[model samples]
Every structure is written in structure tokens, then in C-alpha cells.
Target: MDTNTKAFIGESATTFATEIGIVIRNDCPMNFHKWDLIPEAMKTILYEKLEGKFQLLRTNKAFMKYVDGRLHAQWVRTRGALSRHWKENGGKTYPQRARLQVHSNCWSQDDWDHVCDYWELEKPRVSMLIIFYK
Candidate 1:
């Protein structure tokens, strides 16, 4: 991806990570689980957000697909970071886990909680473990 595209995806992913269901809807059944499952509304919003910086590129399908791919990669990295933070700081009790400091400036306490809740699920935990072991 171009520098401008990379920068935009990074910034937008941060906002999407932080806002979740507020700024953009969490269309996935499990909160923030899959990037491809992200709703068209959110993708449209990202495209609109990019309109100012990438006027001509905005209408390009290849450009949008590239942007979406980069966004997915960014989300994977964010999830890995969050997982690391959880393993390091999480406690036996939910309250203890919830009270831990947020992992990134992009995330609020509620966002952290939502992610933690998702990670608590068996599928996510197993998937992360596989990714970690790899």
C-alpha cells in the first residue's frame, strides 16, 4: 500500500477499534472478530473518510480492496497486541481483568472490556493460541 493509504488505515483502524458499535457498528456476531465481516456501512464510512486525502483513488475498486486488506492486517496486529496485554495483565477475576489499564490510546475501557469478552470465548482463545504458537 502507498504511504497515504497505510496512514489512513492505521488512523481509521484506531478510531474503529476505539468506537466499536458507536462510531461504526460491530456487524460481526462476535464483537470485532472478523474484518471481512465488517459491514458495508463501515467500509463506506472509511471510504468517505479517505475521500479528502485520496480523491481520485477513492472511486477505485482496487484501491478500496487494498485499503480493506491493509485494514485487516492492522486489525490482526491490534488483536495480537490486545491478546498480549490480556495474558500479561489479566487476572482470575473479571473485575481484575476489566480494571487493568487499557492497551492502546485508541481503546477506551469499554472497548477493552468488549474485546476481552470476545477473547474469553473458546474459539477466539483457541485461534489466538494457534497464531501465537505459529
Candidate 2:
């Protein structure tokens, strides 16, 4: 795909992942460990979001893969940012209320808490570390 298309897809995926964290917070299992396991409803919403801007994603496996990668990258980044924020502010020992700061403007406190809960799982922490180091 062209650079413009690639950039658009990446930006759209990030926006959807951050803005629609509520859909993910509600639809996904708290133990969710992988991006590929995202609920079909969430995936459909993303497809719909992208289709409005770029139709080729529907038929193009390569573009679809790129979108998936972008989504995963955003997920990782969001998780990392929250983790870092929590640590920098005061580690887990701090009161939950004090650590309830929203990681993004789009995320509500509940959404932030839910996503933080997901990252708290061992599977996600290990998987994220592997990806981060690689």
C-alpha cells in the first residue's frame, strides 16, 4: 500500500483502539492475552471504521495484516503508557483512587481501570515484555 494509505490505517487503528476502549473493556475477557482474540463485534466495528476511509482493506490481506499490526502496536503502547504512569505516580501500593488517572483523553476512569486490569495478568505482562524487547 501507499504511504498515505498506510498512515491512515495506522492512525485509524490507534484512534479506534483508544477511543473504543469501552467496547474492548466490555466485550473482551479480562484475561484477554492476544489482539487476534479481539471479539468479532469489535473487529467488525474496526472494519466498518476503515471501510469508510479505505475500501481495499476488505479484500487485501496485506492491508488487513497491517491494520492488525497497528492495532496490536496501539494496544501495547496504551498498556505500557498506563503501566508507566502508574509506576511513576506511585507503584501499585498506592491507593487505587490516586492511580485512577486516565491514560488518554478518550479513556474514562473505568476504561483505564479495565485496561490496566488486563495488563495486570501475567500472560499479558510476559507477552508484552517479549514483544517490547524484540
Candidate 3:
């Protein structure tokens, strides 16, 4: 990649890590109360973090993997808080609990197409398009 792209990814990754730490610290209590909302909340935070820069990293595979690794590591760091919440709620830790948390569903080809459509936003190449539309 070029220097600018490299710098952007590096800065974004650093910001993502810092934000994850702050989120875990401040939101642990709310998370404990609403276990089912965790995934959706995380997705929203990630989308917010990538808002202005999504066009930069959208087609970059290496950047995608870097982002995934950062999120996985942060999830690991916050596991203690999750476990504590479960324990306090009389939810015992078990192998099945982890499995249940990561439930997977089989999607048809059409569903996969929909997901791709949702993620792959194409920016207009011409300013005239924006000017005329706006």
C-alpha cells in the first residue's frame, strides 16, 4: 500500500483500540444488565469508528484482517467483565455457554448477496453527480 493508506490504517487501528478500552470501562455495567445487546452495540460502535474512513478501508483485505484482530483482542480483554456479569446473575460458566453466545445460522445465496450489498457502498466518482442530486 501507499504511505497515506498505511498511515490511515495504523491511526484507525490505534483509535479503535483506545476506544474499545474506554467502552469496556464505561459500559460494563450496562452490558451486564443486557447480555443480548452486546453484539449489536459492538457493531454500532465499530460502524461509528469507521464512518468517515469506511471508503478508505472498504476494499482493503489486510486492513480488514487488522481490524478483526484488534476487535478479537479487545473482546479477550473484556471477557473477565462478561464472566463476572454472568456469575453475578447466577449463570454458570460452561462450554455450552460459549457455544450459545456464538450461535450461527446458515444463510442462502440471496441472503449473502444482501449482506454484500449492505457493506459495499460505491462512492460517486464525479462531483457533478453530487451537485446535481443535492
Candidate 4:
């Protein structure tokens, strides 16, 4: 991938991870330590807020794995549409575009700060998603 596309991915991943962390912190605090224990309402909100708009199931799955403490799991799919775009584009960058996808279920910056303060945890990092390059 070109530098720009790589950078976009990095930035998006960070934002996506942050958003997911905030969701978990807000919706499933009672079960934060155990993803499987999260209630259906929490899972539904998370799925709609994250995957529904981004169409990145693999990336969402990776975040879930991270939350579950399953280390070194693949976060994004290498054999998927995103990968095909990179391979077919001859190392060029994707067309510059902005997607303003948001949902009512999202948390505000203040809420995120509260989560950090309450949980004594740091902000999410892009490194949490271990890309499995094939």
C-alpha cells in the first residue's frame, strides 16, 4: 500500500479502536473483563455502532479479541475487499474522501475521559489490532 493509504488506515484504526473501547466501557462495564458475559443489548449497540457503518467485520472481531485478552489475534482480513483494493491499485493511494458516519450510541470525549478515569486505563491504541499480512 502507498504511504497515504497506510496512514489513513492507521488513523482510522486508532479512531475505530477508541470508539470501540468507549462503547465497551459505557455499555458493558459490568462485564468489561469478560466479553462473553456482555449482555445482548450491549452487543447489539456495539455491532450497530461499529460494524454497521464501517462494514469491517474483521476489524471489529479483532477489537473484540483484544477486549477478551486474546493476544496477537488477526484484526483485519488480508484476503478481503480492502486487501484486493491495495493489490489492484499498484501501490497508489485511495481516492481522498471523508466518511461522516456516526450514530447516537457513540460516546463523547468527556465520556471517554470518564471511562479512562474510572477504569484507570489508558486510551486505545492502533497497535491493539495485529494485522495479519499473508
Candidate 5:
């Protein structure tokens, strides 16, 4: 809620939006996700490639508006950049209490605890489910 955080989020959102547009243009699904507002046939190739990795975030209405190629790219770029930013931030000075909560939700809580034993991260209020690569 500070100025820096707000700036980062705003910048990152722009980057995500650009990325989404690029994805649609290239016919590639950057986060292994299909555009809900878009007809499946439009992004059929990308959708097909995503396969079972698709975890519908149906509640994000903003993402739903990505039916247009231009807007989709911008949305994806912003989201992708933000995701990377958060991940990098997690490598240092993470909020211990919050990270524990994420670790708690891990599919294998024990494994998450062990793997993250040395990581210092925070508990994030927002979660992202993007697969950057195919």
C-alpha cells in the first residue's frame, strides 16, 4: 500500500497486459491459460498446448476482457512481469509469517517446509498460477 508497491504493481500490470497481447498475437499461451472472453477457437492452438495445466481463474473479470488481441497482450505482459517480480522478491527479506501460510497450502506441506527451509519469504495475499514456458 506504499507508493513504491503501488508503482511496481502499476508498472507490472502494464507489462502483463503487453505480454498477453503478444501471446495472442503469437498464438502462444504464456501462462498456460486460455482467454475466457475469447472464443476457444481463436486461441485453439495455444489452448491445445496448455492441456491440463489450465486452472481457470474465472473470477478475474479483467482477464476475461482479454478477448481482443491488442488488450490481451498488454494484460499478459503486465501479469507475467509482476509474477517474476514477486518470485524474485521472495528470494530475500520475505515475510516469514506469510510465507508459512503459502507453504501450508502446498500440495505437500512437509515437502514445502523442507524445500523452503532456507528461503526467507512473506505470506502473499495474491497468488499467481502462470507457467512461463511451454
Candidate 6:
């Protein structure tokens, strides 16, 4: 695998998934812990807006995985959590892009520029899926 791919789905991270549903949270606190601060005020409310438009599912499965072979969990799935949220709360607002930053020591300007282009061209539009290869 390339160094760039290792960054998103950690090489060793195990992934657990099923068509019924997938839970992304794993043993490492890095993911869940960081997500803890996501403001509950917006949780149930925001999903409501995304319904019909998309589904946020938390699963161990992804299009790709890192070297270690672990799958991370996701918070929502299609017609899943967010779809349900909007039904409850139809009044809410959303941000255009969700910015995520990471520090790396290997990538050059060209590599990063390419990654940015990929993010916009592919990843989901709601959260701005970004991949910065290290």
C-alpha cells in the first residue's frame, strides 16, 4: 500500500462491517475520544437536514484500509442516523465544509495539491472528505 492510503484507514486498524449496519468506533480512544466534543446540541438536529440527501453510517468497512488491517467506525449511514434525525428536527443549519488538519513529515507540495484535488473531486460533499498523504 502507499503511504498516502495508510493515513486514512490505519494499516493495522481492523474493520468490522455488515450490510445491516456498521459501527466505526474502535478500541483506540483517538477516534471516539476526539468525537466526544462534537456538541450534542447539533447532533440530533444536524442529521435532520441531511436526510434523503445522504446517509452517515459508522462501520468497520471502507473502500480502503491501512497496512495493519483494521476498519474504523462511522457515525451515520444512508437513511440511517441523520435520516432519522431530520425527521425529529426539521429546523437546523449546516456548515459548507468540515476542515480536518494533520501534521506530516513526508509529503511535498505537489503530493498535497493532488490530495486536495482528490478530496473535492471524490469524497462526500457534506463534510469535505480530505486525504493528506504522509
**lDDT per residue as tens, model 6, 1-134:** 22343333333232223311222221111222234444544433433332223343323234223211222234333223322333233312221121122213113434323333333354344866799999
RMSD of 5: 16.9
lDDT of 2 by residue, 66-100 (tens): 66665566555545656677666554556364346
Clash total of candidate 1: 0
Query: Model 1: what TM-score?
Result: 0.59
Worst 10 residues of 3 by lDDT: 98-107
Best by TM-score: 1
Give the runs in model 3 whose Cα sits over 4 Å from its true position: 1-14, 22-45, 52-56, 84-134
Per-residue accuracy of model 5 over 1-134 as CA lDDT, tens digit each: 12332221456556544444444444532333334544557555543433233332335444333324434554455445534443454634564443444321233444334334433333556877988996
lDDT, candidate 1, equals 0.55
Worst 10 residues of 5 by lDDT: 1-10
Worst lDDT run of 10 residues, candidate 2, spans: 23-32
List model 3 lDDT by residue over 1-134, tens digit each. 34544424467556656765554444332322233445756655654555544443646667666555555566555554544433443333343343233211212334323322322332335755445553
Candidate scoring better on TM-score of 1 and 2: 1
Candidate 2 wrongly placed segments (more than 4 Å): 3-33, 118-134
Of 1 and 4, the candidate ahead on TM-score is 1
RMSD of candidates 1 onward, in order: 7.9, 7.3, 17.9, 17.8, 16.9, 18.9
Candidate rank order under lDDT: 1, 2, 3, 5, 4, 6
Tell me each candidate's TM-score: 0.59, 0.57, 0.36, 0.32, 0.25, 0.19
lDDT of 5: 0.42
Per-residue lDDT of 104 in model 2: 51
Candidate lDDT (C-alpha), each: 0.55, 0.55, 0.44, 0.39, 0.42, 0.30
Return the clash pairs for model 3, or none. Answer: none
